[model samples]
Target: MASEKTNGEQEMPKKKKNRNEELKLHDLLNDVVSPILFPEPTNSAPLLHRIKTSLSRNAPLIPQASRNTARDTLLWTRAGSPLRPLLLISVGTITILALTGLLVFTLLFLFATINVVIVSLLISLAAAAGCLAIFFACVTVIYIAALLVAIFAISTVIFWTIVAITITTAWIGFFYTVWLVTRKSLGFAKQSLSVTSSAISTYSAAWGTRNLKHD
Candidate 1:
């Protein structure tokens, strides 16, 4: 019985040491993988009800200083002069009004500035687009003009080539006609000279015969 009691006390301490030292990997994994706001209790409530419950459960705790300040202010208003409370209320009201006005003016100014920026951006985009269009149009016009000029130049070269060929042919025909006319005129002149010389010879021979017969 004494040995059993000693063994039991030793087992209790060993069990406690093991329990304290062992890390729960499964619980850590579950918390990391699927964290739950209220893990033990499964909630199937509507969205608004769930939101209200969640907000209530996590409500902020008020500090004691705020309560003391409130208490002091209440006491001051109750026991002090009525004019002091009235003046404080008036000042607070004026401050709130001024802050509200400033907030509204700031919002309006921001909105107007944003509108102006947007308008300026749109105008800039339009001007850039217009300039791009004009540039494209000018390029197209220039391309067309260059094409027409090239065509005109080609046509002028062809026309001049044909005109030169025609003039060359005309000159060749004129030179051939002049050569033929000169050859025909020279032949006629040689034939006429031969006929005249024969006639003169015949007349001279007959006259010499007549003179001898008379003698």
Candidate 2:
């Protein structure tokens, strides 16, 4: 009991750390993706003031070094931008795909579980009959029947394995098709963000150099 208590105490910090990390990731993803899928509206003010306001709210998710890059992304994705429609489409696509995948997985798992139970029952019955045949070695029909049932059980396993592979391939093809449909918009958004990140990095470097020369 003491050892168990010590182990529990040791594990508490690790669990807390994991929870904190998850929360941080959740916040970061929310900041990045929410700007696109669900744009936030800042009060009507000067551009710089609005940017500052938005940055204040979302800056904690990023490090100081990347704050400017995050700000640039925020500007591009803020409400009233033309990218909203693309955002809508991508978000909708992802939502549908995730739900459908969950549904497919659930049904497949259920089917496999049922198949396993049925197979187990058949195998058990075959084993019992085989044991009886051992007692009555003269019973040829019982032996043949047991062999056929064993064969059928093995065939069922192979058939389900094939079905599972075929289903997985079909889902992969479907996901690939959906990705192809949204490829352009997704590519465009990522490229735009990359450009903005580069621009911010260049600007920061130049400003730092100028400050150093002055000092």
Candidate 3:
């Protein structure tokens, strides 16, 4: 009975140690892989709802000082955001009115300036046209004078050419007449010599034959 009691006491401690070891192993495995095998449940709620729940959950822990500061910041942001849009609208309205006034003033000024300058521009244009007409008239007169000079020069050249041709023709005719008279005189002299020679020869022959017959 004593040994059995001692054995049971020892076995009890051994069982407790083994059970503790198994429990420690199970806890380690759960810590390493529990999120992979079994994830935490997710709440499918709107952002505002989630934020409200989170604020409610943490509200008891947040101090009164932090809450007061948060309230003040929210109030300032609400007030400032509304003022910004009003200010921007007023600035845009002022800028549009200033630009419209400037455009109207510029148009009125341009119209007045054009009305003042148009008559002077027309008078200057007329003066330019008259100057151009005078210049063209002078050029036309010069062209006519040059044409007259050219015609006179051509007529003088033609008259001198005719005179030179007449003088040349007269010289040619005088030379031709002299040559004809010389040729006729030379032919007449040759015929007279031939006739004189023939007559003398016949007279000498007749005188010799009469002398021989008389002898």
Candidate 1 ranges with C-alpha deviation above 4 Å: 1-139
lDDT (Cα, 0-100) at 63 in candidate 1: 31
Residue-level error in angstroms, candidate 3, position 201: 2.4
Q: Taking the tens digit of each residue's C-alpha lDDT, what string does model 1 give over 34-140? A: 32344335666665665565445333312333444556667888896445565456455555655655565566557655755665565556665887656555654
Candidate numbers, best TM-score first, in rank order: 3, 1, 2
Error (Å) of candidate 3 at residue 206 is: 2.7
lDDT (10s digit) by residue, model 3, range 93-166: 55565565556556655754574365345545555688765655565466556655655665565556556555
User: After TM-score superposition, what is the CA distance of residue 198 in candidate 3 from its true location, in Å?
Assistant: 1.8
Assess candidate 1 and give its TM-score to the true structure: 0.34
| Cα lDDT computed for each candidate against the true fold | 0.59, 0.61, 0.59
**Tens digit of lDDT per residue, candidate 2, span 145-173?**
65556556655655565566556655665
| Candidate 1 residue-pair clash tally | 0
Estimated TM-score per prediction? Answer: 0.34, 0.26, 0.37
> What is the Cα-based lDDT of residue 68 in candidate 2?
48
- In candidate 3 the C-alpha lDDT for residue 132 amounts to 60
